[model samples]
Every structure is written in C-alpha cells, then in structure tokens.
Target chain A: MSKAEIKSPLPGMFYRRPSPDSAPFKNDGDSVSAADVIGVVEVMKSFHEVTAGIDGKAIRFLVDDADAVMAGQALAEVEA
Target chain B: MVVRVLNPGLSTTVQDLGRPGYFHLGIPIGGAMDRLALRAANLIVGNDEGAAGLEAVFVGPQLEFTRDALIAVTGADMPIKLDGEEKPSWTALKVRAGQVLSFGFLQTGARIYIAIAGGIDVPLALGSRSTYPIGALGGFKGRAIAKDDELPVGNAAGGREGRSIPEALRRRPGMPAELRVLPGLYWHRVTEETHRNFFDDQWKVAPEADRMGYRFRGGRPLQFVERDQPFGAGSDPSNIVDSCYPYGSIQVPGGTEPIILHRDAVSGGGYFMVGTVVSADMDLIGQLQPNTPTRFVKVDMDGALKARADRAALLDRIRSVFA
Candidate 1:
C-alpha cells in the first residue's frame, strides 16, 4: 500500500511542537500510532492539532517549524 | 420537461446542496443559500437531496413548461402564478404542459427555491451541481439564467409518481431577517462592551450584499487594539496562516463593515472573524436582501450544537417522509 501523506487542511504556520522548548513529536523514521499528534496548526489565535492516523512512521518532514503554509499543502509523509 | 426562460431574474442558477472538500483549491462552497427549502422541494418530488434545482433571487423569470412536470416552491413567499392565477407557497403542485410559471414581488425573504421533480438536468462539476459564478465552473456555463435560455430537465420520473409531501416537512413563512451567531474566533479581541454592542445594535443589510458576502450597515465598527496591521491566513498573533474557512464566518476586515461570508464566499481570507453564524441559523442569513434590518443574537456553543442537532433531526424527518 502507498504511504499516506498528510497535508494541512488550512493555511497557517506549521509548528514541530506545541510550544517552543518542547521536543518534537516524531523524528525521522519515528513510528507513530493512530491519533498521534504529529503537529499543530496555528491560525490567528486558534491552534488545531494535526494527527497521524492508522499508525505509521515519519518518512519525511515536508514543512519546517514556523514556516507559513497554505491550505492543502502537504506537511509530512507517513509509511505504514 | 423543459422550461423557457422569459427572464432570468437576478442571478438565477442551478444549485445542489453545496460543493464540499474543494476549499483546499480555493473553491467557495456555492449552492442554494436556503438548503432547507431546496431539500424540501426536492423531497416533495422524490428527488435526491443532491438534485439540481433553480435558485431564484428576489424575483424569478416567466417561463412556460413545455411538458407536464411536478414542482414545489419554497423559501420566500414570491407571488407565483400557474398561468396568471396566484399560487400557494411551500407546497407541491402539478404544472401541465404549456403552463407559464411567472413570479411577482417577494412578500418575505430574498431568495425563492424552485425544485422540479426530475431535477434541473445539469452536469455535475467537482462533485456538485452548484453554481460558482466567481470561478465560472458549475451550473449552466457557470452563470445565471438568461432570457430565451432553454433549460433541460432530467428525463423520466416526471410523471411516474405523484406523492403527497407530508405537512411535517413544510415550513412556515419566514421573516425578513433573523440570524443566530456563535462568538467568532476573535470574539475576545474586542472589548466586552464592544461585544455587548454587537448583538445589542440593529444592523441593516447593505445593498452591496451578494452571493459572495453580505455587507451590513448600522452596527458600529468593531474596534481592536491596533487600527491596521498585517493579517495572514491564520488568525494567530504571530503568523498569518491560511486555513479552510467554512460557511458563515463573519469576516471583519480592518474594522470595516461586517461582511458575513455566505455560500459563494472565497475559500480563505485575511481578516479577523468576529464570529460565525451557527449552522442552524445559516438559512436566516440566506434570506436577507438589500435594506433588510437584521439583529445578531449571540448563541452559546451548547445552544448552537443543540440547534444544529434539532435542524438535522428536522431534515431527517422530512427525508423519512418518502422512505
């Protein structure tokens, strides 16, 4: 099966961790379970959590922390 | 059945429920502003909820039915005639071949929904039949109905079943304006006094309103700490991020006139959202025309959720009538 690539549903800045000084959720090739918080999407003042579903390993990070992203922009690739 | 357009009215077009899952492509979810009336008319004629129908605004065109068909009129109480005789509202009626369907002035509400039994035969675009005039992608050439235009109807099922629409599915005559809103993402940005002033004041629907957004007058400009600043896609304090904005988001641009984003609004925007018109009260916004005075009442999250659930149940009840 093809790996599921996760993308941001809205435009906003991408954050590796919920806040600064915190460790990232996953590094390269880090295995993650379904519903794992992959990242956070902050728009205006609202912060929405982006989760990795159905268990997968982070194969690549397509977006950097604090980088502005548009809606539907792919953020990460996950391999089951 | 076929209907010849004597007049197109104001921006009339075929529409379905709406176009979802395309906001990522900057596509606005264009469709019938009054989904309740649209679905009700469709259900009356045994059409699917997603069936294409005519969305007429303010006044509709004079058309002659070329073939016998079943139709229902709902939403605004537009003076309609089955060949010059006045007809009732929110009820299904049979129109014989050659009967001219003409509409008079609107008594209440701005939009009037006309759902044909076989459904307005129109090709689907991006998984929907809604008309997005901005993108010129859906409906008949992605524009409003015009004079002398011949509209095609989905063949068959026009004369097969003549079913009676249950009374429970019928809605009473609607008022000019009454919208319920949930506090927006930036509701707290304005002072509590300003927030109080929002619902307390009466706002008139500006003449500049359209499918894209409804500009309102009378309400004081919502003040913020800074007069002007760079706003990004997201409402975050640091970075302006772009996000898929759903329908009913009240976009306040630089403390300008409050523009209530409607069905044909842009996918994403750069502005401060004061609040959103809750899902239950979306149709109320749809019916507001130029110069209509409307008041915004703040609804709590729980109340908003309950209202949405109630509306869903009501539609479910209407859908079950045929089942």
Candidate 2:
C-alpha cells in the first residue's frame, strides 16, 4: 500500500473531533482506511464529513482543529 | 452543431445548477437565477438537470443554428422566433442549420432560460458549468455572451418526440409584491418596532438592482437592543458583525431599507439579517425588475418546509414524465 493524503473539499473551519474537548478522531500513528471519517468542515453551523480517500495510518495532522481551511486544502498525511 | 449570436440579449451567459459546498471559501453560488426554469428547459431536450444553458435577461439574443438541433425555452415571456417564424415556448423544437432564432420584447418577467438538447460545451470551473461573472471564472470564457460569438452545442440526443407543458402549469407569473420571509439569525437584533415596520411596509426595488443583490427603497431603520448589540454604541454603532449569508438573505443596514441578496451575492455580510425569502419563492425574486414594488409576508418554519416539500413533489412528477 502507499501513503495517502486527506484533503478538505470545501473551504471552512476544520474540527479534529466532534466538538471541543472531545478526543480527536485520529491522532499520529492511528490506522485508518478510505471509509474512515477523519474530521469535519463546518460552515454556517452546517458540518460536512471529510472522509479519508485511501487506507493508511495517521502519520501527520497538517491542519489544527478549528483552523480555517481553503478549498482543496490539505488536512492530513497517512502512510498505508 | 453551431449557433451564431446576433445580439447578446440582456446579460446572456451559460449557467447550470451552480457550484455548491464551496461557500466557506467565499465562493458565491453564481448559477441560473431561475433553477426550475433551467431544469425544465433542459429536460424538454433530454439534457441532464445540471447541464449548462443560456440564461437571458428580459430579452434574448438572435441565434442562428448551424445544425438541426432540439431546443426549449422557459421562464420569461420573451417572444421567440426561428427563421422568422413564430416559435412556441415550453416545448422542444427542431431547427434546421440555416434557420435563425430571435426573441421579441419581453412583456413580463425579467429573465428567460434557453436549454439545448445536449447542453452547452462551456468549460466547468470549481466542479460546475455555471457562470460566476464577478470572479471572472466559468461559462463562455467567464463573461456575458457577446455579438458574433459562436457556441458549440453538446452532442447529447433528445429523449422522445415532442412534449407539451401542462395547461395549469403554464403560469403567467404576476408582478410579485413584498416577498414573504422568515426571520434569520440576526432578526432579533433589531428593535420590535423596526421588525414590525419591516413586515408592514412595502418596498420598491432600487434601480441599481442586479443579479448580485437587489437594493430596496422605503423600509424602516433597525434599532438594536443594548444587550443584543454585540458592539456597544461605538463611534460607528451601525456596523454589525459579519454573518454567513445564504441566498435570499435580507440584510438591513442602519435599519433604513432591506437588501435582498440573490444568486451572485457576496458570501458574507455585516448587516442585521431581518429575514430570508423562502427557497421555493426565490424564483419569483429573480423575475422582479427595477422599480417593482414587493411585499414581505412572514411565514413560520413549518410553512416553509411545506412549500419546499410541495415543490419537490411537483419536480418529481415532472421528472417521471420521462420514465
């Protein structure tokens, strides 16, 4: 398998976990797959799920939670 | 197939359902002003619901088809002609290569949509074929149709022989008055008197109105409750916090008049959002021309949902006709 990178489809604030104080959906060294829901992109109180496109392990979280992200902005990198 | 533009009618451009899911990046959904009409026209000629077509305002350009192709027109009542022969609207017609298509003066409504069989071959931007004129992106080179410009027709084929619009469905849309609206997130920021005035008064559309937004005249000024005023009475107390604006959001700056934002509107605003005209009724708003008087009636959330549901059912019925 090859390393995979996850990206946000829309520009919005990224949330690592469901809400503040909640455990992050994935952290470094976590194993994941294409079906995993890595996080969310929230706009105007509406949240959209950001799913991983490839099966891999969470190697790096490129964007911090609640950070504003642009369209096609990179969110994380994973090693499959 | 080729089509020649004789005169680019009032602000003609290729548009579709629009590019959504990118509003957070400050991209406005600059699609067709009348989505239902766009879809209806496309369906008549067997085009996908999201296929790109021509969005004409008030009057339409004189187009001469260079191939025998199927096309349909809907929305406005702009008289249509092919090869100097009067053409019927809301129905598909096959035009020969040498025939010319033209539009007469519009008697009612401001915009009309012309959908060809296979859709237009405009390049897609941000995952859509809709035109976003302000950003200089999408559509035919991301600009309005110009004289002598030739557009390539899509190669998609028509579905069936011919179809007619239901008699009852053929509506001569009346001049819309104040648009009914539901309170938005910032509705409570204004004083009670101001809120009442908004519902009670009639607003005249400003001449400066465009696809971006419509500025209305003759409305009340907003007064914020001291507690509701996030920013205390600073030197510029009129300034409000910027809020995410969906299409049809009415913003009241200084509570004087209301500005109804439509397709091509800015992503966010810093005004008291008094209300949002329901989605179903949004198509009517697109037809309102400058100086038109409109009334705003308030409806509950339930009513809004019911209207949406009704619209969905109507569309579903129309779609089933092809099944």
Candidate 3:
C-alpha cells in the first residue's frame, strides 16, 4: 500500500465540508478516488474544490477544518 | 496569430481598464485587479496601455502561442518559463510558434498580468474586454477563459524584444500595506471610540478579499452611535438607507469586519461606509496577499487629492520611460 497526499491548489481558508452545517466531505478512514473531492479551498472569496487525485483505501486529513493553507500545501493523506 | 489555452489556471480572465459609465445600472467596473501591472505589461509588449490581457490570480495559465510574438509578464513574481526555458519576468521576450508558456508558483503578490504583443483580441463589451463574471458580461466569452480555448491575437505593433520596466517601476506593496482613508458621509455614525479604534488598530486582509471588495479583520468590532432604528434600515445600528458605494468606500456590516469596496463594488448597499480608500493605494490593495498585515491611515480631502496627483505622476514617469 502507498499513501498519496492531497494538496491545495490555491491559498486561503480550507473547509472539510461544503458548508458550515454540512457533513465533512471525507472521514479519517474514508475511501477516496481521483475524482473524489476531499475539501474546498477558499481563495479571494472564490471556492475551489480539491480532489484526492489518487485512489485510496483510507484517507487522513492533514490540516484542520477552516484552517489557513497555501498553494500546494498538503491537505490530506490517503493510503492506496 | 492565435494563443491556445492548455490549462486555464485559477480564475484566468481577460481584462483591460474595465467598462465604466455603467455602474449605475448595477454593472461594475470589472477589470484587472492590479491595473498598474496590466499597464506595465502592455507597455512592455508595445500594446496600448489599456489593451486587454490575461490576469491570473496566484496560479498562472499554461498557454501555447501559435506564432512568434513578444510577451511580457508583470505583477506577481510568478516564474516565467517558455518550453522549459526559464525567462526573466517584466521584460519582453520572443516566443516561437508552438512554444508553450507557463508559470511557477506565485512568489509575491496575489495576481499577475500577461500582455502579448498587440493584445488579446476578444470582442469588447461596453468598451472593454474585461470579464464581469457575475454579470456574464465582457471578456473572452463573457467569463473566465477555459482550457483548449483558442484566443485570437492581433498583430504586434512593433514591440521590441528585451524591453523591461525598471525595478522602481515594477510596483508592489511593502509589508504591512498602508491604505489611506477619507472619512465619508456615514463616518459620523460610528462612536468616537470606534472611529479611533478603526484607524488605531492594525488589521489583516481577510480571505474575502476580491475584485468586488476587501474585507479586513483582526480589529475591534465597530460601535455605532446608539439611536432609534432608521426607517427602511434594519435594526442593526450599522444599517443604513441604501446609498451609493463609492469606488473604495469602506463599509462595515453589522459593525463587525470592515469591507472596502473596490473596482467591482456594488452600486449601493444597506451598509454604512465609514471612509473611502484613496485612489492611489487601490492598486496596492490588489497586490496584497490574504492575511497580510495592514493599517489604515486617515487622510483629509486635500491629502486624498494630492495622493491622486502623485499617482498620476508615477504613471507619467512609467509611461515616459517606455514611450
């Protein structure tokens, strides 16, 4: 098994869920794929989705919810 | 010649000086956030100062040019690479046909401008090629440029290769950018303490900074002068009868974070404006990174006008250096 990281494409605040009241996009042990959205990065008031980019058996978030992040900052790690 | 978009980087858009004279109808003056950078890039490529060009925020687009042409990049310190060959930024360079141009991660500032010789030949809407995405109005299809799009380019007007702006001419904000404000019509609404605190405390650019407005945080909440609710305004003391938002007006909603309207600001809103940032510093605001520390400097009417004149002189100097 190998672990892949999900990185933010742009800098700003990162959110695990679509909205404040919604469930997180992924849990610590959730399975993910290249097309799966792991979180959203809010840059300059615009929201952009961040995909996992790799198929994995389990995912672990590296950054806390609503935390400030930079471009290419690792957001999560997924084990394949 | 034509330019092909290999990858449309985040929020890539065609913009010039923007369409004015229509904000009354709810359309904004939507254009490049860093107008000075756009103008500098265009001048380096020998295009009109306000020629339509690409404005990329943080991430720059990968573009493939169809023919040899001069191109210049300005604003953010995004490394310019042509077909794996690194090139100097802020200087005009010649690219051969089929050569691809790309950029590295943003090193400084928030946005970058790419001015091709003769400019991007997008159809103008309301006298501009700027994209007003919310209105679905101008620019390359009235929206952000998408991948695989072939954008037309005009013939170069004799731009010289290697033309570059001087180091002093390449403008970007210093650490802890200072934005000067002129207290406005509703400035009296805030209590005396709030007024002092607004300028006394240092604030950080919030993540909500954008073309429309920049929200500032890390300051004390505003305290309004207690009074009976004004009619048509909400119960919040910060509420007001909808009034025009001047280009740079600083509005505080619910007396919390302060939001300074920019080029694409709404025509009017229910929030009260405490002041307006001077025109000279608006470009600096555009280049600021989110979370950058900032302070508000109070300016009188004379100070504001002098700052405007100083800005004009700076532009004049830039124009003459290249002209």
Best by lDDT: 3
What's the count of clashing pairs in each model shown?
17, 9, 0
lDDT of 2 by residue, B100-199 (tens): 8887666566678888888988878998888888888898888988999998778967555467466456433355464668888766666788778877
Q: Give the TM-score between model 1's chain B and the true chain B.
A: 0.90
Off by over 4 Å in 1: A1-80, B156-176, B226-244
Ranking by TM-score: 3, 2, 1
TM-score value, chain A, candidate 1? 0.88
lDDT of 3 by residue, B1-323 (tens): 88999999988999999998998999998888889899999999999999999999879999999899899999988789999899999999999999999987777788989999989998889999999987888988888899999999987899899989899877788888899999999888989998899999999989988888999899999998878877898878889988888899999888889998887788997989999999898888888777788999999999999998988888898899886
Off by over 4 Å in 3: A1-6, A17-36, A54-62, A76-80
* lDDT score at residue B297, model 1, on the 0-100 scale: 79
Worst 10 residues of 1 chain B by lDDT: B232-241
Per-residue lDDT tens digits for candidate 1, residues B212-287, read 8888878887766543335444443312345456688887665657888888888775566788988787777777
Comparison by DockQ, 2 against 3, better one? 3
List residue ranges in candidate 2 displaced over 4 A.
A1-80, B170-173, B222-238
Indicate whether candidate 1 or candidate 3 has the larger DockQ. Answer: 3
Grade the docking of candidate 2: incorrect
